[model samples]
Target: MDIKDKLAVDVLVVGSGIAGLKVSIELAKEGKSVLMSTKTQLCSGSSFYPLKASLGTQVTKNDEDKDLFLQDIEDVSHNMHDKDMAKIYIEEIKDRVDEFEEIGIQPYKLSDNRKACFANHGRTIYMLRDWNKIRENVTGILENYSNVTVMERSVVISLIKRNDKIIGAFLLDKNKELILIQCKAVVLASGGFGNIYKHNLNPNDVDGSGHILALEAGASLLNLEFIQFIPGFTTPKYKTLFGEHTLNYCEDFVDDSGNSILDEILPEGLSKEECLEVRSTHGPFTNSLVSKYFDIAMMKQIMKTRSEEGFELIYNKALYENESDFYTIYLNWLTERGINLLTDQVKIAPFAHASNGGVQVDHFGKTNVAGLYAVGELAGGIEGANRLGGNSTGACMVFGKRAAKDCLAYINENSFIEIDSQEELNKLNESMKHFSVHVDHSLTPNEVIDSIRDIMWFNGNVIRDEQNLLSAIEKIEELRKSFNISQFVDNVKDRKSAFKARNFIMLSKILLQAMLERKESRGAHYREDYPSEDERFNKRLFISLNDHELKLEFK
Candidate 1:
């Protein structure tokens, strides 16, 4: 398990998603030796699954100004978003978009030579190609860089800190052997905590590894309570079948019985355009008779059908057969694009997709800790509450570039400091041994993880109350106790699988604890008990560990 013979680099980028890859590309272009690690393979993160769209307001002469964009973000965030950090993100929007174009991302355009608009911003752009194609193109470019090294199937176990600064990291390679990667700078582009919930759209590997790493390293986190739950997804085994792009096309919302509820909310025969006109007056989800009609009775019917048929009925039919039904139906109406969904109804429900709250960092990506920087989903306070639909891609590009810029600057300004790999190995060995002793028969990792996800979905979902939150905390505590005693049948190499489950449990607890503390319904942190948004809790909520205790403070 010793890594004394391992290699070293100038920069270490963890998680090979868009954020990490972009930073590695930028740093490699600058002639810095960059090493990027992926928990699985490159492009396996959430970035690859996006329906080929980029969201953001690029700097322009008309429509949206930097100040106005900041205002919009602040308004959505309820002032919880860090103004300074948001300003940095706003200032870089145009440059980042232009950079993407320079790197071969040809965006689709309207006849007027402008990108299509979405979410009150004109900067939203859709890719003319598929998302997987974009990832392949970017990967091809990255492979050409001589200074960049790609380590597939490597997991960062812990950050190596020296004198309150990050020196490097202890990594577990594919074979589960410990290897120490010494680097002058570390960029955590590791994505969000969506897997903490049971019915999430995020990958199972995304167990908030980066967040927990930052917390263990004593870095600060903000806005943990603001988990966004997107509306407008179909139910009966929820799946995110439709991209928001189809919002421009579809007009009718159907209940489980396939009955159109549009007339119930709107006057009979009102066109989709007309519905949009009065949508502002009636409120977002309330006016949509479709969401209203899919009530408890509808859900009951779907459950009955599933019980009788031994398969879930999603849309008008079973979803798996009509793989592209939702996409096809919407695209055909929206842009004349063709898609096919078989029997599936494109079942959907809003679950946590991304984290707006993460390790606090400055414009340069420097966290409160001296040598540590966060990028991508790990770096928070930029998007605030509800991230604009396509803005995530832009944010990753901008912040990833900035983090590399600052990291390279740090490397040039400072001298290399050697770390003691033996000491780190000793610490890791002891920790591994402590967990290894619990090999007795008990709950499996999968069972414990399922329990954690179900608890989160039930208690910490879109609507919350003090009672549910408290009950969730108790449930999480009980689960954690079970996890501590859980046994793993797998060997040492597969022990990380068990550890991943444990990590999810710990993060779920933190998320619940943070959500319970926030007593206001601001942005995504909606508490039904405290239904109204409170002016007093208007600022960002900061959570940090104080002597093993989760401490809450407002920024």
Candidate 2:
């Protein structure tokens, strides 16, 4: 690698997702030099995927609604949310949402808005109801700016740190060549770790690289155990997210038998329809918002039909007969697969959807480490244990722009100090070379991913017990020891795939470890061995690495 490959920028935004692009656009419009890089093409991440180009936004009715919204976030998080961060989110969300409208997005209001604290409570709006529109509109805005450089198919390998400040990063470009980016600040807007699971709704490239980047950099991540699993597809032959907006017309959760299983399991106080409606609003089962009975019923049905992968999610006849066209996305998704939502039953199982915890950061998306900011799903504290349906999108926009503002302020206050990179660059080169010298097994990337996915699916999924989790930990640890980068770096796709594979193992270990550490069942993460939610375990558990050793503490 030649020194000419080294490039300097005012800010390096890692990820092409909405959050990263949002931040890059913010800075670039202000005439700041910004380099936005993604492992794949623009709009190829979760932002443009199967979720039908949807993003959540919130518009405040008044100051009182903002307070109610803040309370709702804390309530959804099971009281484990960072209150100070919640305050900032509530304060900035309206302004952040207004920016989207300024960019030409028109959000439709729900016909029957829920209560002020619930999903789509009149305050909520969509960044773009259709996903492709987001790609077109958001990317178009970036194209208009002269100060931004969009680099596609660029894989970031490591962050460059010196004396407690992040100066730059090392990346493997699309050509399999190393490029070191020198920047005053770095914003990790990379999404979550959903792709690591067997059944997921994330892009192929979102294999928890952001989490790994933070972990190896010695930053703390909190509440990583709470992975939100929604009822996603199992019968389409290809996996995609089961749109939760259609849950409004759900007829029944019928078993192989002709009975509605939900009717039998729902507790006395909550009716089956009400419980399902609550879940339909958010898609994930959260004890703080709804009762544990919903998740218990769903997971029990999954276990009952475990041999067949999962059970059916049948739609009501009224759904098809209904005059409204609200379900265009669901109808089209079903009809395209030759399955009718009105007549056919779709197999529904818990799919790895959104991650609640990510790099622990303050209100400004700055991680505990200086100059390293995380936006969107890459940052924790906004969503807490279980995020509401529309909040994640709002969080990303609010924090993404906040990170940009803070990044600019930090750059103005401080100048980049010259540091020696020769030694660190050599070590990186040696590590890459070390893989080639030690290649032994004819190991493939898919095999590594498949093995880890199964472990997470069976052991660390919706309902997990102590024995299964412990066994998963052991097996994953063994797999971790056996995996080598050299086995899959022969090709560019495989090299990026290899990077994703490595992050999957490392992040799954952290997830399972966190799950094992939490004995009580709370929100998305459940411990069947200790089913009760304990008040003593209410605070968030954060983890950091010290000299490669795990350190756990509470915030």
TM value for model 1: 0.81
**Displacement of the residue 48 alpha carbon in candidate 1, Å:** 1.4
Candidate 2 displacement at residue 132 in angstroms: 2.9
Runs with alpha carbons beyond 4 Å of true place in candidate 2: 1-4, 101-124, 236-240, 243-252, 255-278, 289-294, 297-308, 324-338, 417-421, 429-442, 487-493
> Judged by TM-score, which candidate is best?
2
For each candidate in the order shown, give its overall lDDT on alpha carbons.
0.64, 0.74
Q: Write the per-residue lDDT of candidate 1 for residues 307-370, one digit (tens) a residue.
A: 2111222222332233354345444432332333332344444455667788888887788877
Candidate 2 per-residue C-alpha lDDT over 1-555 given as tens digits, one digit per residue, 9 for 90 to 100? 433377788888989776887788788877789988888887657765656434545555578687767667777788767788778877887778767643435566554534432343555454456656656676667668878888898888888888888888888887767678888888898898888888887777777898888887768899888888877767744465676656677767766675776887876788767877776666675655554565567677766566535567777676766555556656775677676765655767777878888899888888888788999887888777777667676777788888889988987777775646687787555655423334356446677789998888878888888888899989977776667776566555677777666777677788888898888988887887887799888889898877556777765
TM-score of 2: 0.89
List clash counts for every candidate, in order. Answer: 20, 1
